[model samples]
Target: MPPNPTSYDTASEMAGGPGTLEGMKRLWTPAWIARHVAMVVLVVGFLCLGWWQVTRAASGNTLSFGYAIEWPVFAGFVVFVWWREVRHTLRGTRTERPTPAPSATAGSEPAAATAGVRRPVRVSRVPVPGDGVQDGDLAEYNRYLSWLNANPDAKPGDYPG
Candidate 1:
């Protein structure tokens, strides 16, 4: 079978192997360079904001103490995410795609069964007004609702139903 076009192995091979100069060069494409620049800017901005917060905290603003910790944590998170993306790129792993829903009309088997679901969900049909086929429990509930509507100020506990 032909290799999948979306596979990372194919992409790496096209770039002249993952460890080679050409493969490394592929990481500096316009999109990747933009991403790298953005990550650096965000990390630096967060660190600067953290420093400003720290200075404010030192000047006796209690609220700035929490923000000082928060900004540094945000910077760390940005670094962590950048590192993770680079690692994933080097390892050639693609993000997972969501599985499509099974077609209800495609086969004799139930859609849930075809999709590997153990139990099929049962949906009760909603009754339209003046349907002439009224369920006893539903009728009783509707009567209780009518009583509540008629006596708006009455407590729910006072409902005879």
Candidate 2:
């Protein structure tokens, strides 16, 4: 069964399918009309610029040849972006969401400090014999790290070698 037109999830669907005359009419809204006008102006402006570059190139400014090609490519990019935005507007899908502010309490730690923060986990490693590293050196390094972790305020030079 065909879905009821009025029961659509988006404004575009409510007007009609995207390619239909009715749907196109929806694009005539003030904001969309402004966008349409802007796109037209940009495309025309770019083409004119390209044409100017082409004339300059013909007059023997070699650099203008590259500019002539670039301006037209810029026009194509503007059209592509405009088309993408139009499609997204028609789909009525939002790309971003508002983030909630962190809450604070009297005599409590700041939310920023606790939120999304993880404490590092200590892993114990068993020394493999004949791994080219002396086991005694590995054990001494592990002991040094443990001492550093335990005495957060102590300077490295304070550790007895």
Candidate 3:
């Protein structure tokens, strides 16, 4: 009989196979633990800040500048960290798969892709009468027509209609 193939395949396909908890524990990697810890820290920090502010308001504080002052500083730090994490994610830091790099061959497709393609956007064109009225005046004219149509029994001199 042929020897059993190795359980592991590609880096992306690595997963906990059916076995004892010890085997699974070995696969519980440091990166995974760090991810979970980071998530918990973010959630807990947000909740604590919200709870503190609510408590402060309930305590009948005359002003809210204390929370406001610190909120921006805290928010800025979070935003900076999140941006770096996103950049790393886009760069595929965790995955072993290599992203396809642009080819050196000069072609229209590559040039268009790199230089960016411009799409023609359709804009609504309401033709204004050359001698009739300015485009801005059409709004008031529409209002008048709508009023007249709604109140057919009312005379022209009557309020609006």
Candidate 3 lDDT (Cα, 0 to 1): 0.59
- lDDT for 87 in candidate 1 is 69
TM-score winner between 1 and 3, please give it. 1
The sequence of per-residue lDDT tens digits that candidate 1 reaches over residues 45-120 is: 9999999999999999999999999998999999999888876776563334578876667556655534464766
Candidate 2: how many backbone clashes? 0
Question: lDDT of candidate 1?
Answer: 0.81
Score residue 72 of candidate 1 by CA lDDT. Answer: 86
Please, what's the RMSD in Å of model 3? Answer: 17.2
User: What are the TM-scores, per candidate, against the unseen true structure?
Assistant: 0.49, 0.47, 0.29
After TM-score superposition, what is the CA distance of residue 8 in candidate 1 from its true location, in Å? 24
- TM-score attained by model 2: 0.47
Write candidate 3's Cα lDDT for 1-161 as tens digits.
75456964343333432243433453347974675477557756865775677678668874554773465557556657755664454334333555566675765354334347576799879864587656677777888878888889988788442
Q: Which residue pairs of candidate 1 clash?
A: none
Look at candidate 1 and tell me the lDDT of residue 121.
83
Ranking by TM-score: 1, 2, 3
Q: List the candidate 2 regions with Cα displacement exceeding 4 Å.
A: 1-15, 93-161
Evaluate all candidate structures by whole-model CA lDDT and list the values in order.
Answer: 0.81, 0.81, 0.59
The ten-residue window of minimal lDDT in model 2 covers 89-98
